[model samples]
Target: MIVFMGTPEFSVPILKMLIEEKYNVGLVVTQPDRLVGRKKILTPSLVKQVALENNIEVFQPENLRRNYQYIIDLKPSLIITASYGQILPKELLEKIPAVNIHGSLLPKYRGGAPIQYALFNGDDKTGITLMEMVYKMDAGDMIEKSEIEIDSNDDYGSLSEKLSIVGSNLLKKRLPDILSNNYTKTPQNEEEVTFAFTLKYSDEALDFNQTSKWNHQRIKGLSPNIGAHLIIDNVVVKVFKSQLSDIIDIKPHEIKIENKRLFIGCSDKAIEILELQQAGKKRLSTKDYLNGQNLFINGGMTNE
Candidate 1:
């Protein structure tokens, strides 16, 4: 029997793909449900919800390190993981061969936030990697890769959805070779290795000291989820969309409004805020926000 491990919406397509292909996915392992949102309502991880819907058993260990014997007891012939939040213990992998469907091409963005880093660096392309799961993080030998182009307007939400689809389909195509132990393992180049560590709360703040394009990429990298925010008059405003602006000659952090357009000064150019949310309000377009609020005024400055 095959064991599947994953969490988050990114892993849902992959789990569904396996089910559709009639893989004998005996058990699904994922992180435990936790309280979410201001209401503090308990929420199951997306993968758990999908597993239940498909009538599959799920294992959510509070700490997989201490509670992993359940997985070993099952004696699954193979394990497939995608965006599984926890690292499998070396002992677990020693007994069961496993593979991971990673979000980025191996030897690049080999960490938790590969998709976010790809956008942060303003890359035009990103891809998924199928690799052996070693004890070390994402430093696995690659089995196959599938590339996808990033649209100029793509943000974290859109790009993640795209990459998730690609990742699942790639796994489907490669599963036969994987099960038969007939796949080649290409070791990633040590010299080309780079990391995309998980983002912290502090990483969400926008820095106007950078170029407009740079800040724009930052906003896109964090959008539609943990949004990239700016502090204006000590109030947090989450920015979800922005564009390079032609308005110039303003100092960094300066706020400019003209014809109901909201522009903020960056080091080299101005960035026009397209969509944003105030501390206690729903997200709105720049024009709608300007029509209702006076937080940003001509010549006023945002907190740097």
Candidate 2:
């Protein structure tokens, strides 16, 4: 029997493929969902929804290591863990040789938030790795891997979708091979391991003093998640869309409000704020935002 464990929208494809292939899946373990959005309605995880559609037994234990004794009692042959939130222990590894589906190629970005961190730090190429689970986090021996090229501008939200599908396709092809034979495992070099920690709200703060290239990279990297913020009159204004304007020889951090448009100068480039969202307000473009809030233009602020 096989055991598949994961959570989030990223992990849904692998679960679906496993069921489609008629693999003997003993159980599906996923994390509980929390409420999101303006109305604060309860939301179900993608994994849970897919599991229900296929009629698979799902266990949404708050802590699989603490609350779920049934998994141990079931004693499955192997565990295929992809984007499972918590870390699996040595005890769990002993029962079955668990293989992890990591988003980045092993010995590189070996942690959570790999897709986002890859873009933030400027990596042109990123890939997935199937590896043997070990005590340490993502330091396991690799079994299979697939690589992909990243566009000049790619964010977590967009890149995540591509990686999720790539990982699913790899699992669909490689699972049967892994189950049939004992493949050689190569250990990852600890020196090459780069930790891509989860993004914090604090990391989204933007600096207009940075170089044009860096400013552009950061804005594009964080576009759909943890958006860049600028301090306007000591207020943190979230930047939704920006473009590098014509080369301007202006002082750094000098915000220009012209024709109800917000412009900030960098070392070698000018950033035109097309869309912005202020505290206690909805996101809007330069034209729409200025209509309702005339004070912004009067106060030398062109964005909401």
Q: Number of the top candidate by TM-score?
A: 1
Candidate 1 local Cα displacement, residue 289, angstroms: 2.0
TM-scores for the candidates? 0.95, 0.86
**Per-residue lDDT of model 2, residues 27-46, tens digit only:** 88888876865567888778
Candidate 1 local lDDT, 1-304, one digit each (tens): 9999999889999999999999999999999888986578999999999999999999999888888888899998899999998889988989899999999987999999999999999999999999999999999899999999999999999999999999999999999999999989899999999999888877788899989998999999998887899987778889999999988888798888889888888999899999999888878999999898888873244555
Which one wins on lDDT?
1
Off by over 4 Å in 2: 231-236, 258-261, 294-304
**Model 1 poorest ten-residue lDDT run:** 295-304
How far residue 247's Cα lies from its native spot in candidate 1, in Å, is 1.0
- The positional error of residue 207 in candidate 2, measured at the CA in angstroms, is 3.1
Residue-level error in angstroms, candidate 2, position 105:
1.6
Clashing pairs in 1: none
- Output the TM-score of candidate 2: 0.86
